[model samples]
Target: MTDLNKLSLAEARDALRDGDVTSVELTEACLKAIDAADVLNAFVHKTPEIALERAKAADERIKAGDAPAMCGLPIGIKDLFCTKGVPSQAASKILDGFKPEYESTVSQQLADAGAVMLGKLNMDEFAMGSSNETSVYGNVVNPWRRGNDDAQLTPGGSSGGSASAVAADLCLAATGTDTGGSIRQPAAFTGITGIKPTYGRCSRWGIVAFASSLDQAGPMTKNVRDAAIMLEAMCGHDPKDSTSAELAVPNFEAMLTGDIKGKKIGIPKEYRMDGMPAEIEKLWADGAEMLRDAGAEIVDISLPHTKYALPAYYVIAPAEASSNLARYDGVRYGRRAQLAQGDGITEMYEKTRAEGFGHEVQRRVMVGTYVLSAGFYDAYYNRARKVRTLIKKDFEDVFAAGVDAILTPATPSAAFGLGEMTEADPVQMYLNDVFTVTVNLAGLPGISVPAGLDGQGLPLGLQLIGRPWEEGDLLNTAYALENAAGFVAKPGKWW
Candidate 1:
């Protein structure tokens, strides 16, 4: 069999069901690819023993004719997910050596579906940065490069490693969490499909918190079909998480009819930012045209509050991050700094935090604390919350007007060289999520599909925003876009 690692999740699932391959064989293929691709720094942890054991069990289940859609599929878990007995650090030093005794609800759900866990993928420290530079495990190099240029590019953040691993065929698919474009941005950078389901679509029970309200787990895969399949396996209501939606998980994979005729796709005017690159602008127009050719009506819509999405996200996310990250004061688990003579409890807390958190994490925590302070609470945090409400309402009004999905550029540009933007003003980096944060703010389902290549020969993606609880319809629309774009280009295997 040719490289089983290169097969998409849906293809592998069909092969496994037809008895054309064994789980061990597929797992070995991924393990071999991962071992040879360490230059990417995607897989932070290697779990060969656990992977082989699970693959063996999956083979048995397949033989017994009881395999699920994700059965025997090898996948990478983001570091933010707490896997039982496996290092689950959120790419932060504070969580060093912190392996949970229990599994995260999403991973547990995948395990129950017989998906084999390959290892933990790298991410931004506590999912803070957009470039993945804040990761304690170091930067995840993008597999794609500018034409004939050897400069290493970032795979985009928080979910950078997951994007890289899937794009490089190190694994069939991986789990990614989006707070502010964490999943969609990385997927766009690496030319994969990533969808952030409606808030509470997947249980957040054991995942590390970045911003509780905005953070959500979703699947990053090679195509829309694979995304649909993996998403079905990853979603379900969990009593353990109060925020989880108490609704039935639909058969997303089966919903991919690719016939989106009469679907009203909105083109929001606010996304057409000033001085936007000609390539991104052209790509957005091409995407709208493609959807129009696919029989969907392209309507121009107004989301007047789009300009405030980034500022609101920065404020709200950090504010929640400040409150959620207060647990790591050397009081419970994970790393603890050694104390000096006469050091009191307060000193320990300060010293431990200063040492454990990275620069970006510290900056966000400080900003969060400042916004939540008594004097500035109303000026910053409260006002941002009100803006978030308007953003949500903007989407509601559009949907109420019969817009089925909205189209926009996934990122302002294609992936940039590593360290190119890190040293610049931090706001430059936050702008990476300009087109993506609005979907998260509205708690709606959004997907990024590889659309076309930029002038540099790097991949660019088109995003589709759908109504809440309509991921099935969203995936079907993404499937239509994927088919129209015909984005089969892969990174030239530099890693």
Candidate 2:
């Protein structure tokens, strides 16, 4: 039999239904893979007992003819999702030893559909960094390498672990949250399919907060079809989350007809960053041509405010982050610093926070606090908000002009070595999100599909942004691009 861990989520689903495999067997295969891939640091928490229990229940459901699409499937839950009795740290020391008594809405939904939980995947500490370097568990190494250099490369972030786990076949699929390109960027870097649904599409009830307005949850999988199948199970209305959409969830997999004839795919002129690798430019053009051959009209369009998106996103996301993260003081759940005899509340607060947050997270929180300060509020935060509105308007204008979706390169380039980009300029790291932040700011759906490999044999991906509240259509479009690209390259396992 083929490696059970290598089967796509959809393939595993069918296999279970046909009695070719059992959830227990599939779960054991995944656990074995996880044990072997521990060097990657993809999973920060391991829960084999819980996984086996869930698998047994799933097998029972299947035997009773009560199975759903996700029944008998093993999946990795992002640490951001609060699973009852499971450590739900957001890969941060601030959340050390914190486990929610209740399950997150999204994970709860997947569990209700009979999905087996493998464990918690690592992520950016407080979901702040572009690379997984900010994670307290250590950086997650991308399985892909450049010409066998053996230099460690980041799997992008803050969904780095989810992307890494799926690409390495550690799990069939994993849940990921995107706040200013967390999901798509990592997916691109890891050579997998990841979709960030519209801002309100997935409830953020129990996932750790990043930038409130920009955070969204979606599925990361090996193929577009698997993404569609898992995504359908991940989304729905939840009264617990105020941002949850009231609309009915559609059967996204059934919408993949592969016929995108006459669909208008917009090509943003500004994504061609100066000095970008010629390979990236060529891949973008090649992706466009592939879609064009698939009968979609390719038209060049300008998102005039594209240049301001990063600046605005940096300001706005941090501002919200500062406010949202204020709740993590030592008074509540999670870790607390040891108090000295003379320590006051202020001292405890300072000591706990300083000890808890990592460097990158501290930097963002300070920047956020500064922007929201009285002296700089208008100069920084307010202006950035205005720019955000303009950026959203830019996409709205393009969509209003009859574009069904916009296509662009998912990342500026292939995966970079873990320490390649220096800390002398954090902007270098921030620039990684330049292509993907606009989608989050506009509250639109975006997907990254592995498209090709670079000259060094590392994978590259193409991104598609769709209008709000149209994920089924967006996913169908991704299906077309996925079929056109026929990208089946997997990162050779060296970890």
Candidate 3:
């Protein structure tokens, strides 16, 4: 049973195929693991009834010789994705009692692939904060760390719960959406592998809108192979989402060569910020050395627009967030507040939203409103868009200059104390995304793979980024580094 938790999705599928284990047995094992790890707050909802039923169906199909690629695998769904019968709150009080009539396209696709639905995982309210503390259900503890004291650790957000669950083996692999580093950051913090594909590769049809132009759904898993399998199943075109690309979906799993020979990896000079921890720096350097040993050339390159990326991302993401969040006015969806004397529906909406949103959420809404307001639109939003263009242009130039991909540190440092940045000024939290936000702005693919552990016994992640629609190359490079680093640390077993 314990070995089931350590098996990759492919291995589990083979075990089921070979009749060494049944879907029912695997699901029960995961359920037991979840029950034992409930203190971590990794799950917001556990649909055991639904999960078992699906597992039974999968087992029957496998017995009938109709097994699919991901048949019978239990997977975690992030709370942000709308589930048909589950409350999809995005972990915010404003969304209390809200349920969608439709299942998100990616979720539907996963179901079509025969993956069992474990439950919805926790996340920061409305995907607003870097740490999970902003979740109304409370923070998700790092499963790699023990104890209940919130200050001892943090699960990176807004996809922190998904990361935590996957890291702790609560689920095989999970779905994650990235607007500005949400998936990649948390995956880095939790010492797991997550990929943010090129924008438009995955459908965002029923995903809760954050920054519409930037929101993308991707996979979070224990290794590149499982991630590749999930990504292949999750990606497709949806006519409902106008931005969903009409390109051909590749066989991601079949393409894993584990060979990235002769690839030109560009080390972006500007990403090495001054305050970056020495451990993170060494991880990046070591990653370069690993690639060099794999017969890939490492070239030092510059992304001059990087200095302006975080500022531009903050302005644009918030501006879009402010506009998208207007739907939660209490009349159509989400919670409604009681009116005070002389207050009507307008006042009710104002109070409900004000009381429902967390600090970081409210801050972004205010910034969004201010930037999109009549007097500031041109000065703030427009300028930010122009800078975004420049950042994209920077990547195009580098890729054109014989760079197959770029390599850098996934996060500035390893996971910090849970409360370390919660009470901090917003800018400090914003800066934590410095190394990652630019890739989203450019509509490119990026991934985080565990590189090594830091001096503090925390995990450090090395990031590999690819040009648009080049997830094949991105995953190949990551697999190469994964082999070289050979760093896999499991959370302490308490069961």
Best by lDDT: 1
**lDDT (Cα, tens digit) per residue for candidate 3, span 8-79:** 798898999999998888888888788888888999888888899999999999999998788899999999
Error of 2 at 106 (Å): 0.4
Q: Which of candidates 1 and 2 reaches a greater lDDT?
A: 1
Ten residues in sequence with the least summed lDDT for candidate 1: 419-428
lDDT of 2 by residue, 31-73 (tens): 9999999889999899999999999999999999999999989
Q: Report the Cα lDDT for residue 4, model 1.
A: 99
Clashes of each: 0, 0, 0
Q: Indicate the worst ten consecutive residues by lDDT in candidate 2.
A: 417-426
Where model 3 places Cα greater than 4 Å from the true spot, the runs are 146-151
lDDT of 2: 0.93
Better of 1 and 3 by lDDT: 1
1 or 3: which has the higher TM-score? 1
